[model samples]
Target: MKKYILKPGRHQFAPSSPAVHINDTLTDTEAKWYLQRFPHIAKLFIPLPTEGEVSTAKKSKMKSNQTEMEQTSAFAPPSGGKAGQ
Candidate 1:
């Protein structure tokens, strides 16, 4: 049984983050061995508050960019689905 850390999106796994990948499917000894080799994984176990802060920061940035896009598009006339029209 392989284990993977996944993001909230459907059917998507995050290969990069270490905190989300711990799995019991692997034999206990094997899991221990892997963790021992990649000690950085242990360090990435983020606390709830920190995760919340990170998520909020990302949401704020996204909202800001979206607002800017909406403002810009307001001035442009709707092109009738023509390429570069």
Candidate 2:
């Protein structure tokens, strides 16, 4: 099951369940139930990415950054000389 981090604050999942505090980890099922019960505070449940997802995101971000840098350098003006000089 996936994991989630609860936002800062105390929360009770159910009448019988004890209140959870900030930084508490919750399973995917618990998160889903909390969201359904408290849609108004849906932002409180932050999903944690798996190892594979994290790596994939990093790879994509690196690729995009590299592409941007290449594009920028391609349009850079010539150095050490003024135009039409």
Candidate 3:
């Protein structure tokens, strides 16, 4: 069964279910059942990523940010110019 990580805060999957706190692990079936019963908290259930997956995602994000920075800098006006002068 896949695992999911719950976001920070207390949550009750059901009226009879025990409350769960931040960083709690939930099985795939449990998460699906919880969502079906409490759709409002859908954002709170995050799929647990593997170690390699997390690192790869971080690298991709960093590369994307760097590319955006480069593009932004390319269009920036020369620093010496005074505004409305």
Note the Cα lDDT for every prediction shown: 0.52, 0.71, 0.74
Instruction: Please give the lDDT score at residue 47 for candidate 2.
Output: 54
Best by TM-score: 2
Residue range 1-85, candidate 2, lDDT tens digits: 3466776678765557777634546666767676688675466666577899999999999999999999997777679865566
Which pairs clash inside model 2? none
From the highest TM-score down, the ranking of the candidates is 2, 3, 1
**Per-residue C-alpha lDDT of model 3 across residues 1-85, encoded as one tens digit per residue:** 4465677677776667777735546566777777788887777767567799989999999999999999998877679975455
Looking at model 3, report the run of 10 residues with the lowest lDDT sum: 20-29
Model 2: residues with Cα > 4 Å off, grouped in runs: 1-4, 7-10, 13-20, 23-44, 81-85
**Cα displacement (Å) at residue 58, model 1:** 0.8
The lDDT, on a scale of 0 to 1, for candidate 3 is 0.74
> What number of clashing residue pairs does each candidate have, in the order they appear?
0, 0, 0
Clashing pairs in 1: none
Against the hidden reference, what TM-scores do the models get?
0.34, 0.50, 0.46
